[model samples]
Target: MEFTAALREERLVAIVRGRDPEASFRTVMTLVEEGVPLVEVALSGADALDVIARARRELGTEAWLGAGAVLTAGDAQRARDAGANLLAAPALGPGVAESVRQGVPVLAGVSTAREVAAADRAGAAALTLLPGSVGGPAYLRALRAPFPDLPFVPVGRVDTERAGEYLRSGAMAVGVGAPLIGDAADGGDLGDLRKRAARFKAVCA
Candidate 1:
């Protein structure tokens, strides 16, 4: 499925960032096994590219694996080459354009109306609302008033409750990090992670 369609249909993006390469890769595999349709490995994480490559090799070409925190053209190129079918950035930058040029869907970050318009014009597949909890659902509703057609995936500090609120308020999806991931990426507990993932899927459903 297309990235945007997966976002809308799944309504959640699981973000994995860990200090251990092996742990991070396991965390990603856990999420995939639990049916989290979209997974993004932050490039800031240790050995993120290797994790992406390994996941791609294991999951094959059909899994919705993505690279997050992409900041430059080089980051975009490396991520694509590493087998990420999607790329996400904290803001609209060189990575967005490079991902577009590479024929990969990008989730461009935005906070203001102007930035939203700019990302849209740049051909971002979706707008990622950074620090999404700060403005809350009301802020998302306000942004949607003028750009109703744009796909927005609110990220940061989003819990199961807030995830539903954002979706109801017009966000196409919600990108969850620590809340959903917890310390699973850090080798905390896969059992707990599975429980949380199931809860998120239930809430989003």
Candidate 2:
């Protein structure tokens, strides 16, 4: 399936953000094992490009691995070369449009109606509504009220176990960090990640 369809269908994108590639890989692998089809590796981490390459090589068949925290068009280009199927930014930048124009699916960040409209105009496939806890899911509902047709994915302060609340509120999907896959939070074990993914699936289902 195409990256966009995979992401829109699964509705659970695992984010790998940290300084340790080994640890991050372990965490991501757990999510993959549990059938979480999307993985986001923030580019600021140590050797993130290499990690993305490895992840695509290892998990591309089953998971849509990509880069997050992309800060520039150059970074986005590098991610594309490294095999990221998607690009996720903390903020919307014109370069994000440039990257998406290159055939990379992008989730641009937006906080207000103006920004969301701008992103839509820029051709962003979707928007990532950040700082999710400032107003929680209710804020998402309100944001969607104006752009009822727009798609917004929540990227922060998500209660993975309670993803139903966010989804019902307006989120296209919920990103789960440690709670979905990191062993440090739950013994850093793949089993925990699998179970959590299952639970998320059940809730969303």
Candidate 3:
């Protein structure tokens, strides 16, 4: 399915970023097992590309694996080669164009009206509202007023309470990192991670 469609249906994107590559990969597998349909491995994490490649190898070609924090054309290219079906950036930059050119759907990040417009014009599959907590749900509602047709996925500082609020505010989906993954990616508790994932899924439901 298309990334936007997956977002609308799943209503959540599990972001995995950690200092340990093995632990990070394990965290991703745990999320996938929990039925978190969309997962993004931030490239800023250690050996993120290796994790993506390994996940792709294990999950096959059809999984909704994504590479996040993609900043340049090289990042985009490397991400695709690493088996990421999607690319997400913190802004409308070279990576966005490169991802589009490479036929990879990209979640271009935006925090203002102008950035939203610019990302939409750049052919992004969707817009990721970075630091979604800064303006809160009210900010997202305001943004939707002008760009009602564009898909917006709110990221950052999204916990269980805010997830539902963002969805009700018209977010196509929400990207959750530390709040969901917690220290699971840093060799925390998978059992606790499972419980947290269930809670998030319930909220998104």
Candidate 4:
């Protein structure tokens, strides 16, 4: 499914932005193996696009692989070239709207009221709030107050357990990384996180 539409459909978006490419793959594959419908690979470094391609090939159509942490239109275009079906940015990066117009789903990140307004003006289908630690889901709820149609996805320093709270507090989706994927990501850890993914699913169940 398209990225924005998928968010609208209520599937959790698992973000894979680790300290390195290997960790990112192992972490994301964990969720893919567990039947996660979508995954995000933040374009944090040069190897990020390669990681997205590998994940797409490894998981095939079983999961939708995308890229995040984009800071420019060129980055978004590169993500698409690397097999990213969806594009995300730390904020409304330059040409973000055009990338989405080209068929890449855009989950543009926003941090403040002004940024949110900017993203809306840019036609972002969804917004990813960083440092979810600041206000977490509570702040997200407040952001959605006026723009009830807007989708706010909280990310950063969040764990599997907090996912339930994010959803309960009115977030459209949550982006989980280290807290759930962990620092020791590998096949074994993937197995464990898969179980945790089940727990996340149960919470929304």
Clashes within 3 Å, all models in order: 0, 1, 0, 0
TM-scores, in order shown?
0.99, 0.90, 0.99, 0.86
Clashing pairs in 4: none
- lDDT (10s digit) by residue, model 1, range 16-104: 99998899999999999999969999999999999999999999998899999999999999999999999999998899999999989
List where candidate 3 sits over 4 angstroms from the true fold.
none
- Residue 51's lDDT in candidate 2: 79
Candidate 3 global TM-score? 0.99
Error of 3 at 203 (Å): 0.9
Poorest 10 consecutive residues by lDDT, candidate 4: 180-189
**Cα-based lDDT at residue 6, candidate 1:** 86
Alpha carbon lDDT of each predicted model: 0.94, 0.76, 0.94, 0.74
Candidate 1 vs candidate 4: which has greater lDDT? 1
Which has the better TM-score: candidate 1, or candidate 4? Answer: 1
TM-score of 4: 0.86
- Runs in model 1 lying further than 4 Å from the true structure: none
- Report the error of model 1 at residue 145, Å: 0.3
Q: How far is candidate 2 from the true structure (C-alpha RMSD, Å)?
A: 2.2
